[model samples]
Target: MSVGLGLPIAAPEQLPTWARRADASPFSTLALLDRLVYANPEPLVTLATLVGTTERVRLQTEVLLAPLHRTALLAKQAATLDLLSGGRFTLGIGIGGRPDDYLAAGIEQRTRGRRLDDQMARMRRMWNGQPLGDEVGPVGPAPARPGGPEVLFGGFVPAVMNRVARWGDGFLGAALPPAHMDRLFRDVEAAWAKQGRAGRPRLVAQVNAALGPEETVAAARREAHAYYHPSPFADHVAEGILTTPRAVRDAVAAFRAIGADEVMLYCWAPDPEQVERMADAVF
Candidate 1:
């Protein structure tokens, strides 16, 4: 089973030791992205540095909201990162949940789904080095990989799932229920068949995990709420689905059985040492 780790680009004070321990172990990949656009210090530059220093680790954005920025600019930024990382970048994208983000960007959040679909198309064209409007032959300094890096779409809404099947290379399912995940995969496969695309859709699942003494479960729950309250699966926290390491591992196994290609463990601990301990427990 291939497993990955996801880290949030939040306050420096919020990064646990585990988040900082990029030097150890061999997980499938490391996904990094900020929840709030302006909260982090130079997100693109920081991500580039991480890619430059780390070998054999795939770098990804849990999701870089496209509607919040110009499609051309986003493509350029992603292409640069992909080039710097030797094609190690996987551009995970989505329409953001925060209305405030759109307001801050002076963009409206209406019709975000369709807008995202259009943006995806535009991004692919840009990455292919195709010039927009009235430009030269092709965009210079193409991404290290041909056709640019792989794109993973995030969100579990039915419309989002359909879009993933129609366009994205894969689906980044946020804490989805097991049964719904199965249905989503079926839809993706059906869409692929209808489009005459070969092979199955790549599915990535993210689960919140905390492993430690029983006394720590409450803290973990609070941390999870802080991070995932905006997501669809926020209610699962009370159901005891994401309270322990054992539970998280079982959930990963369950997702695998339901056709998930990879599971990215999202840890909630602010303590770096605890995060490392949890990684030891699962990885």
Candidate 2:
């Protein structure tokens, strides 16, 4: 399986260094997280900043809350990023599970899934040279790839299966155990077949990791807890932290064995040293 590196969202200023290091290292992809009401930098904009700086690493939003943005605007932004990146971009999108984010975006969370469905349809049309019932054609430059950037869907709901089967190029299994990844991936595969999709969806899983001195590890855990606060997910994430070289190796092995196409090490520690530490642990 290909190994990828997630952005150290805890240290936004250091990302360019991390991005260059990840690209030059063994990491095949550079992933970023999105949150409007949080510390993580805005993913697409940050990623765009790296386009000329790195050549080979694929960029992903990890999971952009699709329902929070206007459909046409998102379609254009995504296409522009893909075009500039030489097609090294993936749009990992979802109906995010935070109510405060919804309130901040001034968008309701209750109908997010349905809105994403509509957004996907309209965005596809826009990418393929059709406007959203307007006078002009194509919203922006065509993506470097034929369609728009490959899209991956994220989230834990069964509704996600429908979205993947219908529109996603893959499933983004975020920070789940291999066992859970296996089951959800299988469910996605079954849905894909049921819907008569020509090929199976790509399976990309993530694991939160912090490999270094005790201080870095502790800080990573604290950051993780703060980000996933109040949700049972924080506890789940805590339980799954890979803090040692052996633990990181084992986690990657488990996901690879479970058929993940790629596994991104989601670093909680902001230290750029982690770029080499994680690479050393993995390969």
Candidate 3:
């Protein structure tokens, strides 16, 4: 199994340094978390900039809120990034849990699931060179990849598994324990078989880590609390933050043992050196 790194939210001036450090790391992919109501940079836009600095690592949004944007626009933006990144993009999408994000986008909260499904279908059509029935012709230039960028769906619901079976390249899991992930992988595999798809779907997992000194570990705990505060799972979130080399190794081993293709280590703090420390621990 391969290991990836998550790009933490940071000040504008600090982003370039973050990109350079991640570029230099032995990680396989660089992932991002999305939020319109939060302080982080837009995932696609941040990726657009990061591609200019890095040549090799792949990019993905750990869980970009798909229901929040116009489907066509999101499709175009994703295609553009995939092209610019030399086919190094995988779109990990979800109908976000935060009601505030739905409100901020002025979308009805209840329709999120259906909206995401429709969005995925429409985006796939756009990527497959299907015409929009307008003057622009097919959405071009085509993605750097042949059939467009890979799509991974996030969410632990059965409906989400259904979507994955139909339209996704894989499933994206966030901060889930090994047992939970084992069940999820089983369900996903079953869904694939039920759908008459040929093979098992790719699986990716994300875990939080703060791998430096005591001060950094404390701040990581605080950040974890703030990020998960609105959810019922908030308390359990801290239990997954791997702060030492052994913890990180064990977490990776456990996930990979359960059939994960990649495990992304998400840093809790904004400092680029935290990422460097993570490389030292993992690599």
Specify the highest-TM-score model's number: 2
Better of 1 and 2 by lDDT: 2
Off by over 4 Å in 3: 134-136
Candidate 3 residue lDDT tens string, 139-229: 7668887767988988889998899999988998887888888999889889988999987899988888988778777777777777778
What digit string (tens of lDDT, one per residue) describes model 1 on residues 119-192?
Answer: 87887787887876675455556998888788888876677767777777888876666777788777777776
Residue 206, candidate 3: Cα error in Å is 0.9
Each prediction's TM-score versus the true structure: 0.85, 0.97, 0.95
Tens-place lDDT per residue, model 2, 130-195, is: 766757666877888887899999987788988899898989998778998899999999989999
Sorting all predicted structures by TM-score, with the top scorer first, yields: 2, 3, 1
For this target, which candidate reaches the highest lDDT against the unseen true structure? 2
Off by over 4 Å in 1: 8-23, 37-45, 213-219, 228-243
